[model samples]
Target: MEGRIAAKAEQDGAVAAPRRAPSQQRSRERVERMLAAASALIAEQGSDAMRMGEVAERAGVSIGSLYQFFPDKRAIVWALAERRTAEGQACIAAALKDVGDAEGLRQAFSGLVDIYYGLFLAEPVMRDIWSGTQADKALRELELADSRANAEFLVAALKRLRPKADPAELEATALLVWQMGEAAMRLAISVDREEGDRLVAAYKRMALRELGDG
Candidate 1:
């Protein structure tokens, strides 16, 4: 009986120890710190200047721990882009929910432009990632994929608002609107608020005209 009890105890000990809940919390906190550090660094110095050691130092984590969460700066950049894309997509979707026709589309388009530009202004690092040429192949691919997805979403929204429109023409128009918005936002980053507002207003008018609402 003593031998059987000892064997059972050993078996229990051999089983994997259950992770303490605090351990998970600590891990999450560490990741958040690293991400925050990376964002600040990227924002101040651009993505090209980001280094693993700097990130680790800023994050207050060991280099090994940083690697445990992110393999490289590109991974951090990708994470940042993905997060912003999700936020921007949600904002656009919500703002356009009640929009059903050309006028509504105009309002939604302007709203989307404002939201997107606001997000970029709020996170300059995102603008760097979008316009930077120093990204890795995988990061570039991810960026392209994100842009394509956004274009598709815009096309779908436009089609819904203009059912009688040619699908190909609508897609082309959507791409034009997206490109114009991106370009205008890039220019707005270096300009004053009044100038940015004027540019956005002009683009909104042009987009409305393209949609046959003007």
Candidate 2:
């Protein structure tokens, strides 16, 4: 009887294990659908127009399923913001790779700014989310952390550029650079493409000069 019971338990475990894969896959697919729907809705009507029902309908899922994946619209927006932030961080990392010393730092800084500017320009929704009502306190905190990470990246590049600079001064300079770049990108979005390009170029030059590289 003990052996039979053990055999039955093993059989139940095997049955449960097979079910787990499809269950997890279904969950992931549902979440992906929700995210895709949210992105489309936000792009078409802005965040204000995004309703959970609309997301569910667009994703071809029921409202209950939508809630299962995301608690509310804010949760959806937060997930989107996190995705965009990760993409930006990856781009910055790629741009800085193989970069050496201060002069390399200057080039890396300019490249990083250009990549980020292009990213935001390509995805205006991201800018709208950042500057619009979609931004809540939680999202704002996330943005602050993201900004700090970018600043730290700049600091690392700067240290390579100016190995002799004081640590505190290097950190301060990195923070300034990060802020300046962010402001430049925000301003660029309002102007004509040519003007925006010029603005970014000017900002890059100013940043380089500030770092004493120009």
Please tell me which predicted candidate would have the highest TM-score against the true structure.
2
Off by over 4 Å in 1: 1-26, 133-140
What's the TM-score of each model vs. the native? 0.76, 0.81
CA displacement after TM-score superposition, residue 82 of candidate 1 (Å)? 1.5
Candidate 2 accuracy as lDDT = 0.71
Which residue pairs clash in candidate 2? 102-161
**All candidates: CA RMSD (Å):** 12.6, 11.5
Expressed as tens digits, the lDDT of each residue in 9-107 for candidate 2 is 335442111111125877888788888999989888888778989999999999987776576787677667767777777777677766676668777
- Global fold similarity of model 1 (TM-score): 0.76
lDDT of 1: 0.69
